[model samples]
Target: MRNKIRIPKRPVDTTMSKTTIPVFIYKPEILRTDRSLVVKNHTVKPVLRTLLFVLTLICITSAAGAQTAEELFNKGLESFKWQKSEEASEYFQQAAQADPNRDIYYLYLGIIYHQSGKLQEAEESYSRGIGLNGGERDRLLLNRGNLRTAVSDYDGASSDYSAVIDAGGPLSSSALLNRANMELNRSSFLLAVGDYTEYLVREPESPQKETIEELLNLLNTRLASDAQAAATAAEQALLEEERRLAEEAARAEEEARRAALMEEALQSLSSSGEDTKSISAGSENIREDFEDSALED
Candidate 1:
């Protein structure tokens, strides 16, 4: 037999002007009144053991067979709050299978997989959640973009970020920032600068404002230096072309001057030859006249 320990109820207070103060009575039920009595009650002990076993079996059966999706999701939340990731993952998976249309189940499952380093599964889960086109779409896209970035899939990450930006919501600024980072990874400095600037415009009071501003300043300085270098190279090329043209002109002028001098010398020699011919002819005529006079004498 069991023993019951009873606590007496409180009486009315005499000093409180006939006030009735209610007090709770505690009743404690003891399974054993004495150790020697329990040792003699072997039949009672077996019944108690059977009752505990049946209760535990019923609890397990109900949990495994009769729980709804919402109940499972709540249980998952409790496990997640306690940092029991594996247990939470099991519950979330069950919840998602039970109700495939619910976005939150897949969302939580994706987050759990991501934390567990199951990247492919996490990506698939996020994609499913995004396909539902619910309120968590931006969140899913953002997470998937981050996962793609981790795997060096810059193109996919950029696409996801661009989608989020085009949606034009609270996450647009974050999308801009993430896309800027992806562009930086791809070595697209100009694109990165544009995205970063847009992010700053959208989120003027962002917590990362100072850091982003410093990076932008450095990028601007580098771009300016590159522009100056390109301009200098173009100027040098133009100067080289001009120098080559000038040298060609000088050579042409010198050739023309030498050709004029040669023509003048040829003309002088021809005129002197004509004058000698005339002088020779006149001497011949004079000699002939002298010879005729000598013969007559």
Candidate 2:
């Protein structure tokens, strides 16, 4: 998906036809400056990512296991702040063991677990922390959402992102941005657009404004495409339903016509039966009169 924006123009003549006594077109050297912004746009923002990570670092008061938990937790934080993964993990593990009741203990421990590639442990820790009312609801959900995405749990990720948004924390825009990205991945075009729109409304002066604006335009296009497709499908369905109803009505009319003909034929047959009986009775009376005339003569 990461691609540099380049515009290509055709030469006036057949450049490769130089060997046939024709002209040649030299390759235009795209100036270095022309690609800088494009490159910057495609490159990952490491500093922003790091800052977001730092924001999730928790500071909890381990009351019952004060000395041990406090010492270990501080050590974990200091080590993590200095980018010491192993040391931080060790400290966080010990701190969490010392004060299992402190929600933050499990929260940061889960973060260190993820950093160390202990995905299962990370997931379990996050779940436990969330259940115990972790350090910061918004930050925890954000982290869980990210982890869910890494594991291809799109629905779970969306739910976490939504929870963060509903919480209305300082990172609401960030949550919206993440949710938008997730929606885009799932091809939920207009939904993603909605999230990005909310993001713009929340943070008007965001440093990533230009990039977000570009993304918003692209998402809008996708939304339009999806809407068009849906409309087309709906129209087709309507046509199909109309065709079915027409066929059904034609069949019902044919059946009714057949029933009417059958009723008329039955009535005619009954009348013919009654006429035959009347003729038979009249012939019987005439025969009796002839026999009486013979007797009288």
Per-residue lDDT of candidate 2, residues 188-245 (tens digit) = 7778878888888888998887888998888777767888999999999999999999
Q: Provide backbone clash counts, one per model.
A: 0, 0
Q: Indicate the residue-level lDDT of 76 in model 1.
A: 84
Q: What is the C-alpha RMSD of each candidate to the true structure, in Å?
A: 17.4, 22.1
Residues 1-297, model 1: lDDT tens digits: 554333344344242233333433333333455453333354545655555545434432346446778877887898799987876887788888889888888889999999999999999999999999988899899999999999999989998989999999899888889999888888788889999998889889999999999999988888889889999999999999999999999999999999999999999999999999999999999999999999999
* Model 1, C-alpha of 202: deviation from truth (Å): 1.5
Model 2: CA > 4 A from native: 1-70, 74-87, 99-104, 128-137, 152-155, 284-297
How does candidate 1 fare on TM-score? 0.59
lDDT for 104 (candidate 1): 89
Each prediction's whole-model lDDT (CA)? 0.81, 0.75
Model 2: per-residue Cα lDDT at residue 16: 18
Q: Choose the strongest candidate by TM-score.
A: 2
